[model samples]
Target: MKKAIFLMVLALVFLTPQLSVHADGPDQMIIINKVNNQLYYFDDGTLIRQFPVATGKEDTPTPEGAFTLANKIKNRPWYKENIPGGAANNPLGKRWLGLKVGHNRGHMYGIHGNIRESSIGKYVTNGCIRMHNNDVYWLFNQVAVGTPVIVTRFQGNVEEFAARSGYHVMTWDGEMVDEFQIGRVETLRPMKLYSYNEKGEPIAMQWVPANTRYQVYATDGKGTYTVGSNKYLLYTTPNDTKYELVPSYIKR
Candidate 1:
């Protein structure tokens, strides 16, 4: 009986899941959405906060891949080229979260505060992700070394996860879009519209009228939606008098 009881206890221990030290921490992951220029903070699979960020420029775009936060620095000085840190002209803002990405573990790319506030929503950085000084300082305090940092071109799965978590849907310009529950249509209306290809350019000038329904499948970074099978661009009139679509959805 004693031997059998001991074996049962060993089996229970083996079957139990071991919690990772990194996963149990409040600040375990940071996801950078390059497409919409946003940074998402997740603590144990829950989103803690999000902030707008500026990524790499066209020529020297921010690296798109997974990385680990290797170091944290307060009032870090910049030393790239001849520029010095702590100077008024220094681009590195108030804090820095260094990243270790790719085979170049020694790479100097990181997430840091920026002096140019206007560059927050634009792709103007030289590889490092740039955030507002105040925002970075707040984030720097939340995370620790070895936290996972994923940089991607699009939000994709993270968007869906955040939506399900009851987070507000926001456009790149910070406009709030209506919350849409899955498997439900918000509003249906009849309207006349023209057809446009996936590129958003007009395909034909002929206007087609039909009753259409709106469902939120995916929204672009600019807060535009392509609804239904024909992929109509959902928009509103300048005066906000009525909602319009590029190509009217006509049912057969």
Candidate 2:
């Protein structure tokens, strides 16, 4: 009895309450549409994948707003049901990405794995979002703490929805989204700088030394990469066989 009581207390601590919480460079983001029961994942503002999920029922509706993934837990035990972590009967499946919903320390509300695959794409839960165990496993491996998560029922494209949420980055009609630095772009040949205008049109700005690198701020999604608020460079491939382009940094 004492052991059971201790377990219950521990579980209570882990499920204490709710709270709320930005996007950063080349970061991972999660946006869930409560209206459609879908979870969209993005990397650097690019939609990577989406999965069907289950939100809370009417009485225990999932908290809808902007939040951050404050923590991650693996094989979390379902102590309320007396199920051990990693057990077949564990309702939390094998992973948990807890959200900082408002004021609390991201302990209570979360996106977790559900053993019941049929529960996905349906309204069923206390307040958490339910995903397939496999799906959650994949997401858990890709995302990290401090990742931004947006939960809303807004009607718009995911990118636009994220933009309206206030912390994400997205371009409007091929325009540069922001001044945040993407990375450094090296000039493969003699290069010159151009001014990036509000329309994303490149205008001859100034002259810079050839065979030099510059800190890239943004891109127009065509071939034009920006260097500053206005300065940018037109990246192009050369037919020269002497040198080939290769990434200075590779990300998994």
Q: RMSD to native for every prediction?
A: 15.9, 14.5
Top candidate by TM-score = 2
lDDT of 1: 0.58
Best by lDDT: 2
Q: TM per model?
A: 0.53, 0.58
Report the lDDT tens digits of candidate 2 across residue range 1-252.
000000011112223223222524226668898878999886654567789999999999998766788889998888788899889888888898999877876668889998799999999999999999889999998887877777767555565554434323443322333435455555655655776688987677766655665556665555566565535565544421112222211111
The CA-based lDDT of model 2 is what? 0.66
Superposed by TM-score, candidate 1 places the C-alpha of residue 108 at a distance from the truth, in angstroms, of: 1.4
> Where in model 1 is the C-alpha error above 4 Å?
1-27, 82-84, 155-252
lDDT by residue for model 1 (21-132), tens = 2222224567787778989886533456789999999999887655678788776777765555556677888678888766555237989888789999899989899999
Q: Rate the local accuracy (lDDT) of all candidates.
A: 0.58, 0.66
